[model samples]
Target: MTGNRTHLLLYAVEDLRKPLIQQLLAYPQINYSFADTPSELLFQIAQQPPLLIFCRTTERSRVPTSTPLIILCPTHEYHPAQFIHEPAIVDIVAETDLMRLPFIVLRELREEHAIVRETHRLRTLVEHTPYGVIEVEIDSRQIRWSNKAMHHLFGYSAGEMQNLHIEDLHPNDIHTTIINAFQQMSSGDETPLIHITCLHQDRSTFFAILHRAELTGTGKRSSSSFLPMLLVNTKVSAPCKSMPTGSNSPCARLIKDCTISISAVVGQL
Candidate 1:
């Protein structure tokens, strides 16, 4: 599920300037300002840092981390590699609807959640459990599930978390990175995913990850997918990989590498 619009900050060549600005402003949620040069783009991206960015095809970058870059190119500019590659880039090469952009932005945040009416036993188990549990929807901004531990771990009350957009938990400074991840998920460059972070209630930061699930549940509401878990580190990077990849344990599978203490991992001899 996408957003009404992802707030944007633009960096484009002088040629496509006017029309692109006009079209973007029409969507109320999609806020933006301009950066005529890539250098200017980085400065604005860091300062006012937006959800996504749009630039021309002829543009190049020294920006290391990937951000969603909408390529505005001339008719003849469609090269095979350019159009088909990792990190999907949208084009103004042809006339079309950009309705997909907002939707994709909304989807990327892992913000969608619809409260699932669970059996009493299941609901009780979720609440009483010690692990920080989270039930989220992958397609909408709605946060439909969580336990006390989940809310406690982050700085949000159950009501606050429910009302705010999932992206609120993430620092706005890195929103461009988030939007990039969202676009990748939208374009098949990535799969259902989660990463680790820690967040405090007064709005502090910590380690947590998007809960991992391999199946799609029956969507009771729209296209949103039910996500049932989001694990966080009580301690940062006890090596974020809690278990080694390809491990036999289900818990280990969710985590990349199993790391116990020097004594505990190997057993005290």
Candidate 2:
């Protein structure tokens, strides 16, 4: 097998039929190994874990709980309800439907690849974005992650920011207000775009607009969910003297521009 091909492990007490073996081998993108016993299977996994595992229903218990699996059952014996508690089982197929195996594997691989690509694309966007973004653990109110732009905006290194609480980024005078806002968000209240003062590492303060959104799946807030805040600095030097009479101040213009830009970005996300 070449280094780039997907590796699969097949565990069965009895040999798979010749047709099934040939079906899997026909896919050039896949390379596979067979093991009749649990110990041999585990040894192979220890050396180099396969991307996915194919196992007989009888041998399902022997497969590692962390690995994804496709279970093969005797014809007319497949029961979907029986594997409801087993999160590791991706799909269950009857022995007679072995022809579907290759298609299933390819479908899974394609989906996995798409997820990887999307994750990479998002990470790159975050790293390069001009807007400061920070992710806070909803339950603990601790700073969990931030991008380079975020670090630069607050004048703190990535290491220092990791140890600071979410409150540390704001001035002490408004800590109470910030806490109240967070409580409301946690309680599922509709929060308007927040305008607040933010503190930098040097203790200098600046005006900013804060936009908050949940970072996890839809539903009630959970411990695993994150509160991601997009910070846009609206601080500007005294209104530009070059402006025409009664025109909006630079700060107002900047805030309006930021609000529109952030709304568009959030919509895409």
Best by lDDT: 2
Model 2 residue runs over 4 Å out of place are 4-7, 12-14, 17-21, 31-50, 58-67, 79-88, 137-144, 172-193, 209-211, 214-227, 234-269
Task: List, residue by residue over 113-218, the lDDT tens digit for candidate 1.
Answer: 2223223434565565445655555576446776787776775778877775455566777556654554454333423233444446676677554433222223
- Alpha carbon lDDT of each predicted model: 0.50, 0.72
Q: After superposition, how far is residue 122 of candidate 1 from its true place, in Å?
A: 14
TM-score, per-candidate, Cα-based:
0.38, 0.64
Q: Model 2 reaches what TM-score against the true structure?
A: 0.64
Off by over 4 Å in 1: 1-6, 88-269
